[model samples]
Target chain A: MIDVRKALFGYSEWRWIFFFNKESWLSRKSKNGWVHKKRHSGKSGMALLLGPLFRSQNAPDPPPPPPTPPPELVWEDEV
Target chain B: MNRQLNEINLLRAIACIAVVVTHSITNYAKTYEPALFDQDKFITYFRFALLWATPVFVMISEVLISKNYPNGVRKGFLLKRVKYILVPYILIGLLKSYMHSEGQWSVFFQRSWEIVVLGHWHGFFVLVIFQFYILHILLGRFLQKSHPLPPILISFVLSFTYLYIHAGNKEYRVFIEQVYPFWDRTIFIGWLFYFVVAFYIGQNYERVLIFFTKHFYIPLITAVVSYVMMMNRVMDRVFVSVKSDRYDMLIFALSVFILALVLLRMIKKPNHTLIKLSHFSFFIYLTHQLTLPYLSNLTQTVANTFWSHVVILTFLGLATSIGWAMLFYESRLTKLFTGRIKALDQLAR
Candidate 1:
């Protein structure tokens, strides 16, 4: 039996979970309650954690849409 | 519609002149012995100083592309470039190959293949530019969204590393040679820094103009310092050759680029002469080498001194190239060879 809180959160801060995840321990809720699964995950777990950092931080806002056109008036020449 | 970048035209004109001068110096070196020319040090230093020319051309190309198509290029972009740039490149490559092959069909075909495919001659910049065109298409949205500083820094490192490895590592050189002989200049990695910096400048044109105006001395001092460092490296024998692809040349080129921007920004009104020269620059660049040999030979009899010969060669080279370019540009049939129809319309007015 493993303490899921201690395994996931660790003795340090929540941010330290990334460093502690090397054992590939993932906790899931089973019928019995919280069950720790020793899932052999790839680097994708770490990558998913850090992916947002590499994304564009300050993307420019999109341009505003053009104003709507006014209704056309009938002319005497057309009539 | 984008505002007219007259400063870019001025920069183009300056770059064109620098290129012509560099080629003139090279011609002098080729034709005459070192002992024959008393100004050997000056010529060498000047050549080193003008290493920024080709990179500046690359930067200008990027600046225009980024500025014009900020969102992304619409349909017919590749088609337009192929028609204007690739067509002329092939036509000129064939012409050059024909001239050099001496009427031998086999030799002509081989040379044509080398020139067009391998980028054998001075027109290798066309290959680099085409690579950037593709790169822009792929990375345009990402580059637009992200801040420019990181990309510029990253590209500089990549460019410098590639150049350094190519210059220092024998194995790497051999490997590159096995892959492509002209990889040093022809590869986009070697020139990526300039493109990234140009993208930033093009996107923030007014801001860059204002910044340069406020800090005009920054680029000027940097240019001087980098030039001195380059010359020192040459004197110390730290640098084997004075090619534009050196790691040190990247800094020097960037500084000179900024300096040129600051200096050229002072023109109150558009200089028609400079604009025309800039307009004719591409054609001039393509045809100048063809006329340079003849000009050098012709000037050799007239000018006895080193400076006189160089001056004569440069002047005649520019004159004849511009003359031919003007003729081709003005005429309807030959105007396609100039790679720009819009310039003809501008010139007409």
Candidate 2:
């Protein structure tokens, strides 16, 4: 009988998980298995305001540096 | 001492402390409104832990009534209770009305009316209990000697549904605003769940106690869990700018019952401190609100940090309330407020 009551009411404790920020780390299931999302830096201020609600799985790599302009077109010519 | 009665007294004592804790936090919060939702570590956790105070109180009342009148309520029982409960309520209500009202007769009349109907400050609970007591008598006729389980189950469903759909309804919200003196807490339908659950437990004490003892871990876990759940709701409401009523949450109502039982199990023999407080609990309730304004002043001047300020204010308010109650207890004024020369003497039994 006690087991019955526990089974019915005990799940309520799952709510305690909401208190911790540790659980805020997002993970998603993939073809292989669940994968933890790596947090990206330099989020816009508005994104910061939204906090854990808005999580991105992957950070966009830094834009490739513009080509070196063919060695500055024989540098002396440009100068 | 009867072990069960001692347990009841201890429950009362704990509930009284929780009430003081809740009011202390909130009274300060009224001035330091930011502290309650400030994400302050102490205030947030402390507030959630004691949030069950009011429901615990209502449950205790139901338990007492059910324990004493399990054979079904009678006219004599109602009369005795009414004389004790109603007389004190009226006397205190009149006193508050007199103290707070302006010189105008009309103002005095209006204030007195509000006092009786809505109760003077914390005295509103007396009205709630009075209504439930009368209902208990009427319900007894219908229930006869049947087991309390069926009604408990039925009322739980019905009351929770009533609260869920109607508690924060926009139309009634408009109505409450239109009538400024009206208090929504006086509505008995919104609080039926607490009374019903307690009544059932009181009626089936041995069985329920066994169940609680065997599954005590469940309540321990849920108490913490429910606090976290309540904090989430608080955050959600804050985020959305929606204000929820203090005692209207269904989950909160359920958790309080579970927590009250958990607390009851830990208390084997009632401590002297608890028994004394339980005796004077009502007196404390009647006087506590009067201390809030003064404590509000202290909130501004006493301490720099939110935590220290709240801590001092809580102690000061509780001490002052108890102080006044103690003064009244030894004075002739005790009879005026509580219908006895020594209020604690009668209650200690």
Candidate 3:
């Protein structure tokens, strides 16, 4: 009952789905504007550092925005 | 202690070592010398060979959990998981975070939260295992009275589609990365099939074992072919950080099946070494991430050649992980986190 062929190569029909980029999804949905949100800490920052190595081969996006300091830290420490 | 469970222990032992060796080769080689990782043929094949480690661990987890809760989810089982898995996870996460910051109180809480959520180093595997545990309970209830035919078929379609789409889909990957960026593999969908398949197999343990044993060549051939295909794909690509693709999962599941069949037949008696190592596997899993980088640094400083350096690092990393686990195993605190009175009871229980 194992469909080896399908298991190995069944996503051909939806291959076009792969091409529908998320950036386009973002742009089309946001009629007015969208903010470039900042990741202050946690795994997002780490991924921003290491994402290039494991990113999809088909992606055309630029590097992620630099992480902004947490608002609390910024407020307390800013000169 | 039962003969029936010996094979699972052996599998765990092998899988843990594979994980350590794979991490040592892939991470260290990439960090210290990228070209060597790229150019070296042995390292590539070695990584391919050992790539099944994490998936196999996942499968074993599903199998054991399914066995315990054959009918459906149990409150006791979930509570035990909280004790054995989540508690140690927090403890180990905090410990690693504190160490990473060298006891700096400022960053300790933030770092600990990161470590616990995203996992410190390879601790993401623990999170993946936890996710699978949760999925198993939820799915088991819906799947309680079904004939098991529908679920299997559904998992097949869902799992394969998931793999194919994720592997190919660029936008979805980016979206997922942006949204659930806490160690992407920890997502249950990526490993849905492995856990589901293992759950089914574990439920029908005897029949499946016999089937695999009788027609072993089918799986053997499947694994070999799949591995060859994956390796070919990896070689074709310039970037070599290939974790488990879908093909890799299929091959590894088959391989684990084949390995279980062979081990069950070949070894009637318990191998004390494997059992002992298996007892400490989770302990080692927690501590190995911390130990590997230090060992990698040491090996880089001490060893002369690439081959020698990698070999030293791999074995030393394995030994140090086991040693750390052994220290914890013998210590009085074994009962506190592990929930086991004696060391070997951790495996046997």
lDDT of 3 by residue, B139-178 (tens): 8767656777777677667766766666668897788789
Residues B141-164, candidate 1: write the lDDT tens digits: 898899888898999999999988
- TM-score comparison, 1 vs 2, better candidate: 1
Model 3 misplacement above 4 A: A1-79, B31-39, B102-106, B147-149, B245-248, B305-311, B329-349
Location of the lowest summed lDDT over 10 successive residues in candidate 3 chain B: B334-343
* Residue lDDT tens for model 2, B216-264: 7776676667667666755545322111224335456556666566666
Off by over 4 Å in 1: A1-79, B1-4, B35-39, B181-183, B330-333, B341-343, B347-349
* Clash pairs for candidate 1: none
Question: Which pairs clash in model 3?
Answer: none
Clashing residue pairs, backbone N/CA/C < 3 A, model 2? none
Cα-lDDT of candidate 1: 0.75
Quote the TM-score that chain A achieves in each candidate. 0.17, 0.20, 0.19
TM-score of each: 0.77, 0.71, 0.72
TM-score of chain A, model number 3: 0.19
Clashes of each: 0, 0, 0
For residue B180, model 3's alpha carbon misses the true position, in angstroms, by: 3.1
All DockQ scores: 0.01, 0.01, 0.01
